[model samples]
Target: MLSLGAGVQSTALLLLAAEGVLPRLDGAIFSDTGWEPEQVYVHLERLEKEVATPAGIPVYRVSAGNIHTDALDPAHRFASMPLFVKNGDGSVGMIRRQCTDEYKLKPIKRQVRTLLGYPAGRLPRGLFAEQWVGISCDEFTRAKDSGIGYALNRHPLLELGWSRTDCLRFLARRGWQSTPKSACVGCPFHSNAQWRQMRDHQPTEWAAAVAFDHAIRSGAARGNATGSPLLGQAYLHRSCVPLDQAPVDTVTAHEWRERQGSLLDLLDPEDGPRGCSPWTCRSDDHDAESAVAA
Candidate 1:
């Protein structure tokens, strides 16, 4: 099974499998966070109709729940995202992220178990499935073992010595040049350019992200249990301000300097197009408070 993120790297893997360049895949599993930009869903549909389906591969859609809805519900035990926090003492911090594990990985693992014809608990001995991940050579640091014995993680891209550039080129040659990075619409890890892209071209999703940013200002609910309320406000943007009012349009001095250099230097190492995958989350080493300070 291929862990299809519907992003550049994963999409390339899917296409390779479809074209028989890679081994035939039994299926592709996309674990939806329910807050991805509309383009991701559209791309998934196109892949299913024009690629995967034609190649005799099934695509499975699984989800634990709608992350946006769950985060807002007072009754739900909110799985926290790494929301930028502003304290009354004028210090910045971030909530520890659990959304990736709960919303993304758990559902995909459950589906894998079911596909393996085993119950939710332990898998039978000596029976494991080969699960392909889409980590490329450029992002090799993100690659790791599956940890679980039931599913062995595979990195075909790394084996092929492919990079993100290679994936983009392959897709562009196949007439899929506009594949959007796959991440939740309200992901706090979004760079200013990504936010600007959504704001300028995808206003509906941008508005939704803005509203979600505002809604989470008071921080996540603690269900019906009695607990200390959040001492500071939360924000979706690294600026620790409201998303709509963030400095998305303003080119920072750092960005300006990078823009003056070669094309490769255009991407900010700290704030580039790091799409979130179920296996390779973009928030790996992100420090929201430090980002705000910088």
Candidate 2:
């Protein structure tokens, strides 16, 4: 099973498999969060028609639910994704992230089991599925185990000695260079540059992100850490301001002063260049203590 994230590296991996440069795959799975940018869906459609079809491979799409609706529903208060939040003391802290687990990995796993002919909630002992992830040599640190005994993680890109740059080159060579990063529109892991790109090039998505940011401002009524009634606000932008009004247009020295000693300060000037999938939020790099990605 290949985790088809619809991003550069994953797309390159699928293309390579289609070209018969790698072993045939059972199938590819794309776990939709239902909030990804429109371009991602467009790219998926292109791949389904041009690549997956001629390759004789099937691409299965699965979703647990609409994360946007799940997070905002008054009846069920799911924890907001680990977005950047400004504190009353002028500090910033990130909320704990559970979105990837709930929205990505679980659904893909469930679908993989069903594809394997396992009955719901019943798995034979020692069932190990070789799961291929698209992480390349550039993000080798992000390579990780499946963490469950039922699946084994595999990295074909790493074995091929491909870096992210190589993946881009491959796409360019194939005249399919427009593949966009795969991420939820409202992901707090976005850097100022990423936010600006959305606001400038993708206005509708930018509006949705801003709305989602405002929606999560008051902590969820049910699943927050306090486990009590809400008491604070949340902001998706590192500046702790509304996404539309945030200073994503420019990063000033004064803004740097305030962000000093904060998690955002330690991040690379931009977010990781790839989209995130289950088991790899990439937002964990918000912590200064977290391992750096190459």
Candidate 3:
């Protein structure tokens, strides 16, 4: 019961673990941040033969143990972090809450605290795990509670009420339709229609997030983990006129709503950095969708 790899909520948590309803198939994690998005590894290889080989469901990956621990760990070094925007001269837009808590929730709380046996380096004396956080109870307030004791979160699409049209009728009764709403092919929560489908279908991840936003802006600095360099400037939302002039979505549907910012403010953002935290996602490496904060 994990489903943070987000191929239609990991095929609706493997259709509620093939309708047994999650007795135990605790797998499908997918938290690697080597700049993802070749259709998120082709929907995690068609969600591992449709949800991990017909309900075996163990597709883990939380790597990032190189490139200098992924560049001082601003969450797998999307060339220095700090998204969560509104700063089109409105000021006050700072992201980087540690890139989904160190590349997606510390390797999913070290694999659900070693499968609830506990004892990983701390905190396992009380609620001895039961994590199950796919979070689609229409995101029941990002369903938090890591008070730390093993855990105790549990949503299972809000205890089987489910929405987003019951996750599209349980992924079209397993024929499936769409998925791809996870993150990190330059994920500033992409939505100028997912940055025109990653510059019209993955031009090498839109030229590697426009050469990683011009290689972290020529000197690299998103400071203030007590380093004191940033002043709120990083562009991966394509053609705010930065990363080598990237702004050509052929805008003429009335200038594409001034380059997009109000489908209910990118799905209910009053501040910004929108929501998608199945395991641990503040989501980052910006392209420009919006909403997934806290």
Candidate 4:
């Protein structure tokens, strides 16, 4: 099974399989967070028409409900994404994210199990499924073992010596020139440039993100496992202000100069550079806790 993220690299991987450059896949799985930009869904349709159908490859989309509600739902008590949080000490931090695991990985695995005729969470002895992830050569460090006996992770792009730039170039040659990065609509991992693009080209989504930013100021009711609200306020923009009013359009001269190598650069936070899957979220990295909110 191949994971189709609908981003450049994963899309390229799917195309490669369709063209017989890689192993023919049983099908591709898309784990939607349910808050992806509209363009991603559109791209998925285009892929289905132009690639998946022609190749006789099926594309399956799975999700554990919409993440927006799942995070805020009091009954589930799932912690909301740690976008950008404002602490009482006047400093900002990001919440430790659990969304990818809860929303992305688990559902995909469940579907894979169903397809393989395994009972819920039960696998036959020594039976394993080979799963392809889209990590590229430049992101080789993000590659990881599946760590589960039921699934084994593979990175074909890395083996092919491709990078994100290579994937973009390949897609451009195939007449897809504007493949955007894959991510949820309200992902705090987006850079200022990404936010500006959303505001200018996708106003409706930007507005939704702004409202979401506002709604999380007190954090989710289930932010803590114990059902307590967060100690800090949440904001989508790194400035600790509302998203609409945040300085997403322009970076100050000081900010531009300082942001280049600073830890606060939200555009390419850890687990980014490429879109993330549960295996590559880097949430386990101890340093991410200390990094400034995106």
Q: CA shift at 18, candidate 1, in angstroms?
A: 0.8
RMSD of every prediction:
3.1, 6.1, 15.6, 5.0
Query: 73-130, model 4: which lDDT tens digit per residue?
Result: 6677564575777789987788877788788888888888888889485678988778
Residue-wise lDDT of candidate 3 within 94-178, one digit each (tens)? 4555565666667777777666666367653564656566656544666677655666667677777775446656676666655
Q: What is the clash tally of candidate 1?
A: 0
Candidate with the greatest TM-score versus the true structure? 1
- Model 2 regions more than 4 Å off: 77-79, 221-227, 251-272, 288-294
What lDDT would candidate 1 get against the real structure? 0.83
TM-score of each: 0.91, 0.86, 0.33, 0.85
lDDT of each: 0.83, 0.76, 0.55, 0.75
In the range 15-126, model 2's lDDT, one tens digit per residue, is 9988999888888999999888899999999998999988888999999888888877767747458866656786667787888888899988888788877847767898
What lDDT tens digits, residue by residue, belong to model 1 across residues 143-242? 9888899889999999999977787778878988777788999998777767888888899999999998988888876533347467799999878888
Clashing pairs for predicted structure model 1, backbone only = none
Q: What is residue 124's positional error in candidate 3, in angstroms? A: 15
